[model samples]
Target: MNKNIVITGTSRGIGFELARLFADQGHQVIALSRNADPIRALDHPNLHPFATDLTNEQSLKEVTQQIKAQFEHIDILVHNAGALVNKPFEELTQADFQKVYQVNVFSVAQLTQLLLPAIPKGGHVVSISSMGGIQGSMKFPGLAAYSSSKGAIITLSELLAEEYKEQQIAFNVLALGAVQTEMLEEAFPGYQAPTTALQMAEYIYNFALTGQQYYNGKVLQVSSSTP
Candidate 1:
């Protein structure tokens, strides 16, 4: 069956891979990113690309308008656009933390709320979190801002799942670990990541296909060991 899916952060990395995988599987993919020109150049039949900055409310409003104009309903909504700032607590400024939260937490919730009307009763809402969100205060250090933002996402996902349980709209979080995306490289330069973008994409796709109510309201961890 074909699913109408809208995904953010589709310019590259995990979001790009996820969009390609879903489109290849005969699903309608509305790809959202800051750079729409590149996504438009793909010219895939199952793919529709729109450009918008997730952190900017005005840009997000324009993106939402486009989605409303194109599709009557969306079966899947993936919140994958996030920012990470990895610096020691002393080096991190309040502005830096606020910026990260704006991208990773605030915009995510705002976009989801705006698009909730378009999500059907049985649709899915997937928030891409991080292992750091679950583990909390990692020994790796220098990730306070990024980790906190992800932690907030996890909490938000749980609350959303509970709030929308009666409506039957599933809300779940994927706590990914060390995926080899541009974001990961930026967060931990010179470090070898554990997972690949394609692998993470496959995991997300399979999870979405299950369509099981049991997965709803849960934070499913996806790593090298998870299958």
Candidate 2:
């Protein structure tokens, strides 16, 4: 069966790859992002692109309403928009922390809540977290804000899964390692990325299709070493 999937941050990175994969597989994909021009160029028969600034509550609400009106129910929801601010703790200002939290945590929670009614029973919600959220790596110096926000995402997904267990809504967090995306390049300019976006996207799509109850409320870490 072709599922109706809604993905955020589809303008690039893992989100774009996932959107392409789902559409190619004959699923209906509604992609929301601040920059939709690239996604619009995809113009796939199964792809629908919506320009949305996730940080804007009003815009998000309107976008969700449109999605509900068009699909009635969403089979899968992928929250993939996030920000990375790497700097010394002293260099990080309150604005930096607020900006990261707004996009990574606050907006995500709000959008999920707004769309909860449209996510049908047995649907799945996937939040893209990071290995930084699971465990602290070597002292990165200036990743406190980014790591803290992702930690909130991990906790939020777990709490949502438990709260909506009766509704058959599975909430899972993907704590991914380095992937070859613009974000990675921006974070570590000269460093080589460890994984391709397509590889990560393929794995996530397959996982979503598995209907595996065991994944519910779980945080799965995907690393370059993982099979």
Candidate 3:
């Protein structure tokens, strides 16, 4: 069955790949990104690109309204967008935290809330987190803001899963390790990762479609390396 799916951060990296993968599979995909050119270039009939600013509340509301008015039901919602700031803890400011959380945490919650009505029974909500977000996991120096924000979303998914369990709208979180994505390259130039964006997207694509049947409110650490 073709599904009405929504995904964020579709301009580049794993999110971009995920959008294309779903569309290629004959699913109706709404790809959200600040810049929609890349998605538009795909020219896939099943792909619908919408430029959206996740950090802005007004922007989110407008997007959700448009989404609800278009798609009668959203079968899958992938919160794949993230904001990262690579700065020492001492150098990070309150505003830095706010910026990261706004994109990584606040937007996820707001988007879900606004779109919840359009998600019917058997819908799945998958949040992309970081292995660093897992408590007691390997911590890095300049990722205090990024990791903590991911952690916040992880907990939020768990709670939402429990609250909406009766509706059969399963919510799950994936704490991923290092992936050689544009975001990673921008944050740590010249560094290489064992996993590529396409590789990770393939994993997420399968999980989003079928994992809900066996898991809800679960945070799976999908890591291939330490750190």
lDDT of 3 by residue, 57-153 (tens): 9999999889888889999999999999999999999999999999999999999999999999999999999998999998988989999999999
RMSD each, Å: 2.1, 1.8, 0.8
Counting only residues 3 or more apart in sequence or on different chains, how many pairs clash (N, Cα, C under 3 Å) in candidate 3?
0
* C-alpha local distance difference test of each model: 0.86, 0.88, 0.94
- Which 10-residue span in candidate 2 carries the lowest summed lDDT? 134-143
lDDT of 3: 0.94
TM-score of each: 0.94, 0.96, 0.98
Which residue pairs collide in model 3, if any? Answer: none
lDDT tens digits, residue span 67-160, model 1: 9888999999988888888889999999999999998899999999899999988989999988888853243578889888988999998899
Best by lDDT: 3
Best-fitting candidate, measured by TM-score? 3
